[model samples]
Target: MATAKTEKLSASLEDYLEAIYNLSVDGSVARSKNIAQALEVSRASVTGALRILAEKQLVNYKPYGYITLTKQGCIEAQRVVRKHNIIEKFFVDVLGVEHTVAQKAACEAEHAFGPQIVEKLLCFIEFVNSYNKNGYDLHDEFRSFFRKHGSIAAGDSN
Candidate 1:
C-alpha cells in the first residue's frame, strides 16, 4: 500500500525538490543553474520539472526568475534529503562502498525506503556509528549475524 506522501512523490520530483532545498539554504531563491549542476541534469530538464512543481503548488516558478519552494515543498524536500543522507551513510559506512559509489547508490535507495523504514535505518546507523570504526566490515558482520539468528518462518512463502 502506498502512503499518502509516497503516492505524491516521484524520484525525479524529489531530486529537484531536494536540490532546491539545498540551494535555498544559503539564500532565499534557488537558481536553475545551481539545481541543474547539483543534480547533473540538463537545464532544459530542470525547467520541465520546475513547471510541474509550480503546477502542483510546490514551488513558485517565474520564467528566468529564481525558484523558491512553497511550504509544502520544503517539508517534502527535508524528508528526501534526510533519506538521501541516511542511505549514503549506510552504503559508505556499513556496506564498505566507495564514497562516490555510495552516493549514487543512495540516490536509488532513498526512493525504495518509506518513512518508517527510513527512520529504522537512521537509528541503525546511529547505533553503528557509536562504537565502530570498521567501516565496510560492519555491514558484513551485520549480514552474518542476521543469517545466523533471523530465519524465515516455516509457513513463509518464497
Candidate 2:
C-alpha cells in the first residue's frame, strides 16, 4: 500500500527526491546545479521542483542555498531507493537481465510499484538467495536452461 504522503507526490517529484538523496549521501548538502545535472533538467526546473518539495515539507530549500531533506523526506526517499534497489536486484539476479538494462528498468518501475509488490519482490529475492546459500544457484540454472532452449514453444515438450 502507498502512503498518503507519497501518493501526493508525482513521479517527477519522486525522482527529484531520489536524486537529492543520492547527492547528499556523501555528507554534503545538495546544490541546485548538482540536482539539475543529475536529473538532466534545467536549473529552472530544478528550482521549481525544489520549491514544490519545500512546500510539501519534504525538503528545506532556499535560493542560492544548499538543499537538504527533512526527516519525513529522508523516510520517503529511503522508501523510493529501497524499491529501486530491490527491483534492480530481482531483475539482475533472478531474470538474468543485464545490469545496465536492469538499472534503467528499475528507475522507471520504482515510481509505479507500490509497497506490496515491492515486498513480494524482496521475498522472492530472499528465496533465491536462500537457494544459492544451499548450494543451488537457481539463477545459473535458469540462464543455462534459457541458453539451451532459446525460447520454448507453447505445447512443446522437448
Cα lDDT listed for each candidate: 0.82, 0.88
Note the residue pairs that clash in candidate 1: none
Give the local distance difference test score of model 2. 0.88
| TM-score to native of every candidate shown | 0.74, 0.87
lDDT of 2 by residue, 101-134 (tens): 8898899999899989999999999987778655
| lDDT accuracy of residue 63 in candidate 2 | 85
Q: In model 2, where do residues sit more than 4 Å from their true spots?
A: 1-7, 132-135, 151-158
Worst 10 residues of 1 by lDDT: 1-10
After TM-score superposition, the amount by which residue 135's alpha carbon in candidate 1 deviates from its true location, in angstroms, is 17
RMSD of each: 8.5, 5.9
- In model 2, which residue pairs have backbone atoms overlapping below 3 Å? none
Model 2 has a clash total of 0
